[model samples]
Structures are given as C-alpha cells and as structure tokens.
Target: MNFFSASYNSNQDLLDHLKSRGFLESETVYQAMKLIPRGDFLPVELLDSAYQDSPLRCSRYGFNASAPHIYGKCLSELEIEQGNSVLDIGTGTGHFAALASYLCGSLGRVHGLDIKSEIVNFARSNTETFKSKSGLNINVEYFVRNCFLADPDDNVYDRIYVGAACPKDYVHQLLKALSPNGIMIVPAGEELLKYVKVDGKLKVQYLLGVRYSELELPHQHEIQISYIQHEREKSLKVLIPKNGIDQSFRLLINDQKFSDVQLYILGNKTPINVHSFIFYCRIPSFFKEFIEPQQINLSESPLVSILLPDFVTEKNLMMVLEYVYCAKLIDPTIFESNNSSPDQVNLELDNLHETLLYFKIDSLVEYFDNVSTILQNPQPFNLFQDCQSKHLQMLVQSFNKIPENIGTDYTFHFKGGDIDIISSETVPHLLEISDFYDDQFLKSHCESILAKSVEIDNVVCLYILSSRLNAKQLFRICKEFIIENYPKVSKTANFQDLDKELLCQLLQDSCSYFQLLFDRNDSKIKSVELNETHSQNL
Candidate 1:
C-alpha cells in the first residue's frame, strides 16, 4: 500500500484545472501542460481522477507524479527557451519530464533521474508510451541513481527541477551545475524556493509553502489564484487587541497587512478575510455586526459598493483610513505629551482638519481646530526667536504657518549645538498623534515662533525643537540668525547665563519666556515706551 493517502473530490479537466488554480502562470506553461496527457502517466486505478491536479499513487511508498500545479509553476518560472537543457530529479512518473521535453522542443536535452529502480523503469515505460505519438521529438534519458553522485556529461544545465524535498542548505550543491542565468526550482524543506545565478552568486526567492515528502505526498493545493488574492492560513493573528474594535475595523478596510482570503458577509459585499487565526481575536466584542458588513451603515453607495456616509466617498474613506493607520504607526511620544513637539502637532492638526472638513466629518473639525489652537497658543515648539516679550506678542498676529510640503533640507549651528533639518520628515513626525481630541496633544504644538522671538536665551531649546519636532524649516531660519550674529550673540549676557554648558542635551526645555509671559497676560500688549525723564519719575 502507498504510504500517502489522499482524498480527491474535485472534478475538473487537468489542463484547465491547474491553469485556473494558478499552477500554470503563462501560456507557455499551459501549452506545456497540455503536451503531456496526465492519464497516460497514472496507473489504471487512478484514471478516474487523471484530469485532476492531485497526486496519485503509482505504486507503494509516497511516490507522487507531481500535480500539474507543481510542475506548471516550476516550468513557467524557468521559462524554457527552445534548445535549453533540462534535468528532473526523483522523476517518479516521467510526467514532469514529458512536459519539459515539449518546451525544449527538438534541440533540447531532457533527462529524468530516480533513485528507485522500479519507479525509474515505470517512468521510462510511461515516457515510451507517449513520446512518439505525442508528436514532440525530444530525447529523454532516465537513470536510477542519486543525483548528488551522478556524473554529468554536460558542464551546466539551463533549467533543473527537483521532484523531492531537500533542506534549503543543500540548494548550493544543486546550484553548482546550473548555468549562469539558469533557473532552478526545488522544494527546500516545507518551502518551495527558486534559485537564480546572477553575477556569479545564487539569488534565492521564496515561491510559496510546499509539502514534499518521501513518506507522503503533499495535500492537493489549488495552484493559481487571482493576482490580488492571498491565501489565508488558519494561524494568522488579526490583531484584535483586547480593546481592539478600531483596529479590526481598520483591518477590514485597509486590509493591507492582512490575509487575502475573501469573506462573504451580508448585502453581497465581499472583503478580504484576513489570515484565519483564533476566531475570537479576529472579531471584536461587537463582531456580530460583521455578519452583515453592508449593515454597517445605512448609507450604502451602490455605485461604488462601499458602505459610507454622505460627504466621504469610497476613495476618500480609503485615503482617510490610510492616514489613520499612519497616525497609529507614529511614536505616541511625538504627540502624547512632553516627548513630542508643537509645530509637529500644529502641522498634523492642520492636515487632519482639512481632511475632516472635506469629508464633512463636522464632529472632528472642532476637535482638530481646538488641538491646533492648543499648539499655536502654547509655546507650540521649543523653537524661539531672539525678540523680547513685546516684539514676540506683536509677531503672534502674523500667524505661524505650516507648509503643505517641505522641499529643502538645511543645516543650523547654534552655541548650544549643530543640527540638520530634514524637510520631508517634519509633517509625518508631527502627525504621529493618534487622536486630535487628546488635550495633551493639542497643548504640544503652540507658539514657539513667538517665544524664540523674545530671547535667544534657550538657543539649545531651539536646536532641540527643530531636531525632535522636525521643524527644520522654521528653526533653520532661527539657526541662521544665530550663526550670522554668533560673535556678538555669544558675547551677550544670555549666552553666558545658560545653566547647562553644552548647547544641546539629549532632551532639554524648548518653550521660552515669551510663551510663558503670553499665557500669563490677560490682555494684549500695546507698544508703549518710556523716555529717560518718565523712567526717572517712575
């Protein structure tokens, strides 16, 4: 009795079957698959299932004539140009070799080798039955011997297929005989791997998971799937954290990092069913709602087939959803509290505000606006101007601006230290805040523009401000002002007064006195000056 046991219930024509299942990726491969009649390779007992792409027992211990899916993918990836030499190892049924012969045509040399004598003889008989009538004039040599020990008449092969599984480490030995630019397809342990020799080194790429065994043939698997589809394994973790409702919903929408299996829910709508995992983790406490995904919202747009609200379209939803995911990826400290910068916060709030208003998510507009004021009102970022309290207050009316895009990177040198500012990273770093409604996040992005204007007292704070908040553009100007006036400024009382000797500490205070004085004042300041006589009278 054969060691491997298989259950084949699928009813499909073998050529169409493997192609549909994705075992065959190209017209060349499908044509090659059609060249060999699978029925001729199998024993009489398996004729009923001959057209199917499942392994059949030829005789005894786990000797499987590889299904069309297995051989088809290998052949397609190899891309056998006419006249190329081909090798098949552990070729039990010669079905794989037969297909290879067809692709190589009249000028190609194809050889099938098996370690077992009976299987080699059987494969030879099988090849003989079809070779002549098949109308493909390709000579194939069959041998019963270990491929590792066999002497090759030729120095290298254009393409090689290994019918049995070997450890990934053994790939090097098989690769030795592969010509430069040749393709080798093999099962390394439980994984199917392809090796190509490029510029004199083997470059390996993982094809997919495979189960090749001497004791048992691999379970029949559907070879081809849609280009966008991904097969799901039952062990995938869907990231349904204990309080993970939002996470699962995002997974349902973006589905970028999840599995490719489709889940048919209510309303004829289908979404990617992520990798199968513990079902409990995939769905939230309210997961019963997904039983009917269309029931998610009453406003379903039939045109796009995506369930959404009035102002936001399917495209908008995807964009906003992506932004939400990006926000989550950010370090919480950037938007959380003291760890983050205000210009970053203000910049992020502005983006969120624009998106929210466009989507007419009126509810979030106020939240983002409030957060913006929080950043703009407080010292915002540690970046300070060398101006005093009065001058800084007057400048606040100028309104700090966040650029839609940053193009130039600048370098700044301060008595405190030197800093490099990146233009692109500034906004992404600020948008790290997860929630606009978070009060602390709102407070982090206030008016550093005003404070820095008041005094160059914390030049180090300005340096750190640009570094941490990625507010390089704003601080770059401030840093240049300091560098230009370095001689005069360094001699000032303020430069000598810094408690910390080094300009930049790992982390230091950024908010300056202007912000403190502004927040303390109940009324706006009007510029009033005292003459020497008036000062003496006071």
Candidate 2:
C-alpha cells in the first residue's frame, strides 16, 4: 500500500507535495485544493490530521474524507473546468463539493447528494461557512436522496463524480444522468474507473486500485420512515409575529435619535421628528414635496422643518405617522378617548381614511374599509355590546395585517402565544360579511373557526349553512361529525331538519366509510395468516 512517508504541517505544504508527486497535474486542481482549507471540513478530534494524506473517518455510517492524493488524482482525471455543472454522489462533509464549486466559479452550479440528512446538513453548513469567509460566488446545493432511485429526467450534469463504490448494475442508471459528451469518475469494486460518454456509448478507462464502501439501498421500512418524516417536516407550521422591522421603525417614529426631517402640526409647538428615508420609500410624493426640496444631506445637514396645512390635525398626523412607520393602520381606539362615543370614533376614522387616500397609501386605505365593516357589525345578534368596541378594535387591527394564505388555522400570534379572535356565535355573521365583501382571506378564517365549533346541538344547522355557502372543508367536517356520533346526532331536534335527499347522501357516505374500514381489517388478517402459514412450512 502507498502512503505519505511524513506528516505535513499545513494545507499548502500538502498541496506542494501532491504537485511534486504528479498527483496534482493541473493548476485549477492546485488552486481549488489550496483555496479550500481541509481543516474546516474535518471533525474536531481529527482537525490536527487534516493535512495527512491518509483517509479520516467522518461519520458513523463508515464515510471518510478521501486522501488528498486520491482527490487530486480524481480532479485531474475528471478534467473539471470553469462553468462546468457537476454532481457529487455520496458527497460526505462536502469537502470535494466545495473544491468543485470553486473550480466551477460564478457561472456554474454544483449539487451534492447523501442519504443521511445529518451528513447533508453538515456538508451544507460547512459549505456556507466557506462561502462566507472566502466570498465564493457559486451555488452549491445539497440534498438528501437515494442516488440509486434518483430521477435522471429531473436534471443532468456536465460532470458527475461518485464518491462511493457503485455497484456494476447501477452504472448504466447513473450514466443516464450525464449530458452528451460528459465525463464521470467513479470507484467500482477495487478499481477506480473513468467513463466518458460519446454518441450514446460509454468509453471506459481504469484509473487506480482503491477500497471504498459500495453504495447500498436503504431498507423498505427506512424508506417509509424517511418519507413520513419528510412529509411531517414539510407541513410544520410556525407562528411568527408580523412586527419585526415595522415595530423597530415604529419606535423611531418621533424619536430624535435618527430623525432628519421635522413637521410642525397646525396647533402643536412640539415638532414631529421623523426619518426621511421612511417617507422616501412609503410615501414618495410626500417625501419629494416636503423633504426633497430642502435638499439637505441627511447626515450632515440641519433638521429641516415644514408647517402642515390646517386639515392635517396634530392627532390625525400622529396616527398617519404611526401607519407610515408600521405599514399597518393604528387601532382607531388608540386615539379615541375613553368617553368617546361611537359617532366620534366613526368621524375620526373617516378623517384618517381621507388622509391615507390623499397620501396614496392605498393598502392602508383598503384596511380601513374593512375596519368600517367590523365597526358596523359589532357582534353576532349584538350579544357582547359592552366589550364590542375593544374586542372588535383588536380584531380589526390583527386580522387586517394577517397574510391572505396564512396556513391552516386563523390564530393571531400575540406576545409568544396564539390568541383566538373568533367566537362561536360570531362565525356566521362574519362569514356573511366576508362573502359580501369578496374577501377570501377573511372567508377562509371564518370557515376554519366554524368547522371547529361543530357539535351535536348545531351540526345539522351548520351543515345546511356550509352547504348553502359551498364551504367544502366545513361541509366535510360536519358530515364526519354527524357520522361518528350518529345515534346522538339522530336524536337531536334539528336532525329532522335535514331534507330527504341530503339524509340519503349522509347514509351512503357513512356506509362507504364503514365498508372501507372493514376491507382494510380483513386485508390485514389475510396478510398475517399468510405469513404464519409460510413460517410453519419453513
């Protein structure tokens, strides 16, 4: 066996030795090897031996970072060039992938595949760290995939390097993933081999004798578990507050620390200090009209002050500034006094909407339109009149800012917890308003709340309502609830309210559900019996 006769002190010394030994034949190979530090990819315990020519164990799955000589010879044999898209099969720790990325440069992309997510994640993290430090402008993507099962139709690369010993049967499968006239370097059995495709034929050449782990398929149960885990990860929902940058900007609204522009309202002597850039992006017309004409440098010039017209009240201007900073309308109740009447609140909101439209903040103008609807319909049947003002104000503030397609439930992320905004009795009225206003965002939220509120007392009526509204999700939930608690649901007063045709449909659906369950249980029994019989015979 050939090995390094002496230990090296650094990566450059190792590269110099490899070049002298004829392993590193090309300047691109030498530069790539020198640019990427091997110590960064090694485990903490093996960091001292990173410059050694011998392979080092990297994972419990029996993967190793190949010796420097082997990598150099492979890169030299592969003849990788700039702008060549490459794929690294069984890419562990991403050391070779990083070097390949540097070789490919800015115009090319590299892909790495490993079956273990842990290995893939480690490789991705190491590559990102290298990119950050070296400032490499290349796209190197890592994926957790079974190479044998990869779909060749998805993508083909100009260069493919297999880091594991591929079985003879899978060679043709991998060759299918190569572009016309593309080259592949792979280790098969005890000999490293190179294959170049030309005119739909593989021209093979033997490179060297090397021992490597042969690629193997994961177990059936492992594949199933991996798929289920992937699905669970894909569907994971996170609740993030809509108040990060907007909140930070809101705090500096009237603060003098970074203010470059000042506005003096008609009645208030205290100037409203503000950042000029906020207005520059959000309300460009206002910024150009008031702040731009001053033509003062933001950092070096004095704070320029402008007097507002009579219509821009101090109170309304403050609210406008809040909206300008937050990218959301302030709660109307924020400026309203405790003793303020509904009529007073309405008048103030009307003035605020006019101000928003005049400044061309169209989105916030649309938000106040919905707020007007919420105020008009305080509660379903006016049940909670005392808390209506405060609750509805919170609802309008939170709901208007929510994204249209926020996943699954409609819970507001408040503080660090979820706050449910919809009450059981209020769903129908809210649904009506959502439909009338052509607001699919609010309609989706109302349907989700209404579906959770289904019960024996109201399942029949809710079912009819869902049908009337053509709510497919709510209809399915109500139908399933009715089927599951049929005995109790049938005895309810509103059970007879279901018409004859709809009642027959529910009976048919229940029969289909029971029949499917029975068939699944029977199949399981037969499978067990066949297994037991085969075991007895053996």
**Top-scoring candidate (lDDT):** 2
- Each candidate structure's TM-score, on Cα atoms with residue i matched to residue i, is 0.38, 0.43
TM-score (C-alpha) between model 2 and the true structure:
0.43
**Once model 1 is optimally superposed onto the true structure by TM-score, how far is the C-alpha of residue 225 displaced, in angstroms?**
46
Residue 300, candidate 2: C-alpha displacement in angstroms: 80
What are the runs in model 1 whose C-alpha is more than 4 Å off?
A: 1-12, 60-62, 150-155, 214-538
lDDT of each residue in 1-538, candidate 2, tens digit only: 3555446999999999999989999998898889887888877878988999978887554588888888999988888888898999988979989888888887887999998898998889888887888886646899888876634235798899999898776687778778988999999888899999889888999999998877876543444444444443322222233444345456677878556678887778989888655565567666667777785444555577888766667778877887666544455656466677888777777777777766666655555678665466443221101111322222233234322323112222111113254456556755553443233445556677776677899999988887776655667778888988999999998997788888998999889867866765666677679889999999
lDDT per residue as tens, model 1, 238-343: 1112422233234445343432223432343444233211111222221223322433343533111223334333333445444332222112223456544788
Q: Which 10-residue window in model 1 sums to the lowest lDDT? A: 407-416
